[model samples]
Target: MTVNSVLVLGGGFTGLTSAIALALRGVENVTLVERAPAWARVGHGITVQGNALKVFQDIGVVDEILRRGFGADGVTLFHADGSVMMRLQTPKTGGEDLPATLGALRADVHEILVERALELGVKFRLGTQVVSFENHGDSVSVLLSDGTTEFWDLMIAADGIKSSTRPKLGITAERASSGLGIWRGVTNRLPEMTGGIAYPAPGDEGAYKVGYTAISATQCYVFVLCEPQRTPNDLPDWQEMKRLMEPFHGEFDWLRESLNESTYLNFQEIEWIFVEEPWHRGRVIALGEAVHAVPPLIAQGAAQCVEDALLIADYVTREGDLEAHLTEFQERRIPRIKGVVDASLQLAYWECHPGSPDAQPGRVMAQALAELVAAP
Candidate 1:
């Protein structure tokens, strides 16, 4: 049965992408509800991997993304002093036609996605969410925060790791902390900072890793991954961040010096959650971060989320057996989602425990990427 009306919870990457894909596929009525009154445009840069770029291409936004973001050929791992440790030619998971990675500010990416979704006639309501939902045999009835009741053929939950709709479906999944925190900010892009660069060595303040990537022609994003067990109840001052990053040389010095009160800095503890199978019950389904949220160690979180959106759009627009299609969606996505979540967790574990014998980040990353290269 073709779903004529769909309600999408959350307006992040997953929801927005799903709305765009569904509208493009000719769904008559698609509405996206976001809890936030306005877009959260404040965030550090993000690396949109090649696999994710494929989804953007499918949805017809790849050219705009490339225009607004910086494309890089490969990644380089550097020693503490900025000396080269290893150079890797990353696989073009999207295709040979796309770069291995594209870095863009979070605000830019969000705007692009929202613009595309709006252009396709996907309705959006801000500062509103699902108050409750009742899934009847064939359709789902949703009670929204706006004191309105709407009946839709399907409901999709992309409401982040702590999804309120999960409990309505009797799914109990809780996000677990990675015991690590990160500091991120943007600054002027140095001429030599051509691609993604990482420093794996420990810094002065027990920072496990430091990395930076160009997000635009003249700007870059920087991050410092600190050791776990530190409470981040308050945002640290620029001096504290600068002190923590003082151990490295080269571009680190530049980044360290670039810190100021004007810099848009942010800090947060990393957390993840992976829900078990049966992602759908009745006519409601969960996808993206709501089902599987992982750390960005391997940069597959957005890619997987976009994949889920594309698949959901494909399945829900079909002309037969909704339950079977939902089941098939979970079946097809489980292997890939499991691989990404496991690899990301392993990488987080390795970072938290530096010398664990079981840590093989490179191998895990390679295996995960190999699996993701195939069409979802």
Candidate 2:
């Protein structure tokens, strides 16, 4: 099957990378549509593991990303009183050629991808979405939010976890609330990069977990996790910071003092979805969060999205039956994605319900990190 024109829904990390990869390899007429008016993605920070860096290297943007982001060597776990519990060194999975982990402003990463896509002549139709999609035998007829209908040989739905295209194609993807809500903020970076810091829940602050990393030279992304039932609005003052920072007595003193109401804070409950049989229905295929949405415990959400784009681009450029290639693609992706998502969920579950005798504090983390050290 020869693919002429391609339409990608959502202008996210996955969509932009897909468009650029296809265009770089000579996939014609690749246009991406995004509902957002601009490329301002939500969230403050993202941690890209080594595997993600490997993918970025493949797309020819790893150096730019590394130049703008802070690469870390390891992570440190602390007890409530700032006592060192354990320090885990991050292995260089992308190989010794690249840093094992990188901490970046989510907006910076977004800008890099979007700018690269534009440089590669990827067209983006912003501020509109897909209204309807009809899959013909050889091509797909899609109605846009602007009342214009277009045709494409293939349509890639990378429209995030709450994707509009999945249900329209009669795919039953179940998304459930993970019962954990996280509070995130950007604060002044410490004088030194103390690797990454994590404090487990059921602490002095009442079942709250916190993790923070230096995202840039002068700033850090801090996240405090709690039960989903708490209202984030009530946590707008410095008193809220005092409670959240009760665990760390030493290094966090300055970061706590840097908090104010003007500080940008975001709260979101973690939700997950793993769409079984995420493909197969004529000309449309799924990618990114639409197919496998997971918690950030393992920090593979964005990495997996990038991987999805790269793999799809690889298949689209190959000479073969598109459907057969897609079947093989799904086969290669589903198991790895399931393992990563399930491991993340298990760690989150143990955090929320810390009553299990079989669950250890850093055991799952160790195992999951090892599994991720090898490329998927």
**Best of the candidates, lDDT:** 1
Candidate 1 ranges with C-alpha deviation above 4 Å: 200-205, 229-235
Clashes of 2: 0
Question: 23-110, model 1: which lDDT tens digit per residue?
Answer: 9999999999999999877888888999999999999999999999999867777777878877777778898899888989988988
Index of the highest-TM-score prediction: 1
Estimate, for each residue in 184-302, the C-alpha lDDT of model 2 and write its tens digit. Answer: 78777775754556564352444366777877788888877778755556654445755767666546666767778777777678889998764757889988998888888878899
Tell how far residue 164 is off in model 2, in angstroms: 1.1
- Model 2 misplaced regions, further than 4 Å: 200-207, 232-242
Clashes of 1: 1
Error of 1 at 32 (Å): 0.8
Q: What are the TM-scores, per candidate, against the unseen true structure?
A: 0.95, 0.94
